[model samples]
Target: MVIATMFDHRVADGYSANMFVSSWADITRSQPPSFLPSFRRSVLNARRPTIYTPSTANMFISLSKLPLIQVDQKNEPNLDQDSLRSRIYYIKGDQLKKLQLLASENGCQRSKLESFTSFLWKITAKYMEDSGYLDHVCNIAVAVDGRRRLSEGEGVEKEDLMAAHFGNVLSIPFGRIHSKDLKDMPLTSVAKEVNKLLKTAANKDHFLDLIDWVEDQRPKPLMSRPFAGTEKAVSIMVSSGQRFSIMDKMDFGWGKLVFGSCYAPAARRDYYVMTMSSPVKTDDWIVYMHLPKKHLNYMETHASHLFKPLTTDYLKLYD
Candidate 1:
């Protein structure tokens, strides 16, 4: 059974998404040489599909409370190094089987696997410092669809059917706990925390309240990016854009997309994870992750059997 769904706007193919990207490139290219070289270089070198990677350089404006200083802390438990170490692990075959089992036993879906895994990793890292598990915190930010939550009446059937449903249908509910806490506590207790957060965010009324809260906080308009103060947090946002009706609409001269997924660059030390429908097989999914090298190394050593490397062929990166 599908746990969540996404509705995409009708577009011929992934190429259609490139139109806006191309325009952005053109705009940047047409700019005069007097423009800032850094900005000019960024646009000129932009790729067809851009992935947002978090960098500790010049992105943050230091406030009085937190000095706007960039520190190199790969050896320390700093956000700069931690975010770089975070990575996405792809699961299939037997590993997928084990994950499904864990999700089923916990009365959840495979979508929750990363957070669950992160929870366990954090715990093990704490007590067994010598275990080589990196000291980190794991937080799962589940994406909530706001279409139904914000829609009027029973909702327009056609709008729901079409992938064109726009507006902010996205909401992220996060579950955070330290690695040491998981290590000292039982799995059941950890699961409870995960479930509690999921349930609270799943409520329709709760989301409405959230919208109100955000409106009051921002007053004007704001983009949905990670909060600045959360630089030290190891949070992962999980979004399921598989149900977007647009995947089937890939017909801009080229054949239909065998699969479609989103790409998230390692922007911060915090974990960023996304799961989308695999074009190879509808039942399967393709997960894209950009994590730090240290965490990726640790996961590979310990959980190597669970994750399969996503090759360029599978993602059609060559094409």
Candidate 2:
């Protein structure tokens, strides 16, 4: 039941996968899907007059100047980019509920994905600290589906089809916390910080402003936060798959799809994490991570109880 899928990072992102798979299901069922793919460049076409917020301006400046997502810094010659590895694990609903309770006790509120992200963030910070990079910046770039937000930015009503528009519309918003501070912060506190930054970047106004910014920089390459810079840094980007309708939206005659998840390109340099739905377990989740081999080793030994490996037997793919 473990549906492992790897797509070109160029053609589709996390959000686009749902529609892509659903379309295939529709074809198999000989039924027309909800809507055809919309690749209209006009969707994200730059605005005539440019606009920007001070916060986004600052972010753009940092991305333009800093080496935020470096693979292997000459400074950290010991680390090898080719040594990166991938792992799949499941987080039980009960376990996630306990973590959420622990987070709530600290006077912070967050969704399951955010809570889990905070957990991973802390773990990553520890790895950096152990590697003597406590002062280094560690970034967590989160992928936000910008379709609804972008449609809203354009003053489209919620009842409008644009709200549910199918496209490659997305925003890469991130929070940069120093390793030392992240190491010292409480779990809930980290999640709160993450939530705040992501909210600003994922809101309707942000997309409007992003369009303006792109307009101002016409004819130039637009780079996301993670792809920018990272001379002395540790980073991870997480994408949430909470909204994908695995049970209903994907049923194009297939008796309820069992499971679905994304696999990143093998050659990707930065660390990545994806939280996905469990086909069988309603409250549980499947977390896929592409991270450093050494760090994966540490986590496997230290927190293996929490992140169980996904085997073919677990997926019931074989007899």
Q: Which prediction has the highest lDDT against the true structure? A: 2
Worst 10 residues of 1 by lDDT: 35-44
lDDT of 1 by residue, 1-319 (tens): 1112233322222222333333333354563222111111121122334332222112222233343646456655433344464344445544555554554445654334444444444433442343443555555556666545544344575324322332333455565566556666654455556666566656555545554454343434432333343344455565554554334544323445444455544444445555655555455555656555655565667666665566667556564
TM-score result, candidate 1: 0.60
Candidate 2 lDDT at 92 equals 80
TM-score of each model, in listed order? 0.60, 0.85
Best-fitting candidate, measured by TM-score?
Answer: 2
Q: What's the CA RMSD of model 2 in angstroms?
A: 3.5
lDDT of 2 by residue, 166-242 (tens): 55566677787888888889887888877777788767788878767766765554566544654456778888887
